[model samples]
Target: MKKLLIIAVMALSFGTYAQVDPTFEKEGDKVKATYFHANGEIAQQGYFLNEKLEGEWKMFNENGDKIAMGNYENGIKTGKWLFWEGDVQKEVNFDNNRIASVNNAKTKSPVVIN
Candidate 1:
């Protein structure tokens, strides 16, 4: 019906603008991304290049606190990375572009607090 056609056109137009251009390699490749909490205190953003995460990435908690930060090389996590959950600070090691180990701060009594 004519009404159905109109609705379909409207939907298609909206979808086209709602998505980010994730395909940065070849021209005219469709790519999409979603950003969280744009106006809220906490904001998180990420992107997909050619449908793969191929750059720096960041994440934050609802309270506007940084939760994690790292990079993606060809969609694989690589290089130094840091992760924070609540009050805990963790340092992660990577090898061959993969996570090797994670080190967290140790808690100690007053006598050994360093």
Candidate 2:
């Protein structure tokens, strides 16, 4: 599920590069990264540990609107992830790098899989 989701996102976002250079900073044992969009807006910001994504990460649109927010553990998706799609917000729960459940906030309906 995770792989499929990633591939779909990649396919959808064909222009996913920033013209400006990205910046990175060291925060104790972790490194903080801030990526920019082509128009210089912050695309995403997150922390990495030992070259792997760790802790909370946030994604934003070119106009500076936050589009998604989630957490990672040892580079793997974990816990609840929220994504904004048009007028709706989608919540996905992940366990062991796999989706456990998904809820559409606007519809108030949840889709769960064992």
Candidate 3:
């Protein structure tokens, strides 16, 4: 029992410091990057131009589920971003890091015929 407790403590301690390093690949003048979660799952992925976030980026939750996806230009958020919240999916459009619009889609209930 003592040995089991020690192993559990070690595992928890390691999890506390778990980190995922980003991998970069050169593409012309920009570099593409993929960041992983502590569980070795992809957390976020996008491109960098001049060392700034650019192009399309995707973010996932720790469970490897897509949480948000959008585009960036020179570290500025642009285009539409989709986010998952409970049973609803929210779409946010950004322009130059500013929110331009928002749309939400929720589950619809079906009607029963008499």
Residue 80 in model 2: lDDT? 99
Candidate 3 runs further than 4 Å off:
1-12, 108-114
lDDT (10s digit) by residue, model 3, range 5-111: 99999999998879978899999999989999888889998899998998888888888888898888879998889998655789999987999999987754557
- Model 1 ranges with Cα > 4 A deviation: 1-34, 37-43, 105-114
C-alpha TM-scores of all predictions: 0.53, 0.75, 0.76
Residue-level lDDT of model 2, residues 4-94, one tens digit each, is: 9999898768656426889999989999999998889899999999899999999999899889999999999999999996668999999
State the lDDT of candidate 1 residue by residue for 1-114, as single tens digits: 999999999999886555333222243442334344533443445556767775667777757788887877667888777888766778787776778998895542366656
Give the TM-score comparing model 2 with the true structure, all chains together: 0.75
Q: Give each prediction's root-mean-square deviation over alpha carbons.
A: 9.4, 12.8, 4.2
Model 1 has an lDDT value of 0.66
What TM-score should be assigned to candidate 1? 0.53
Alpha-carbon shift of residue 75 in model 1 (angstroms): 0.8
Once model 1 is optimally superposed onto the true structure by TM-score, how far is the C-alpha of residue 69 displaced, in angstroms? 0.4
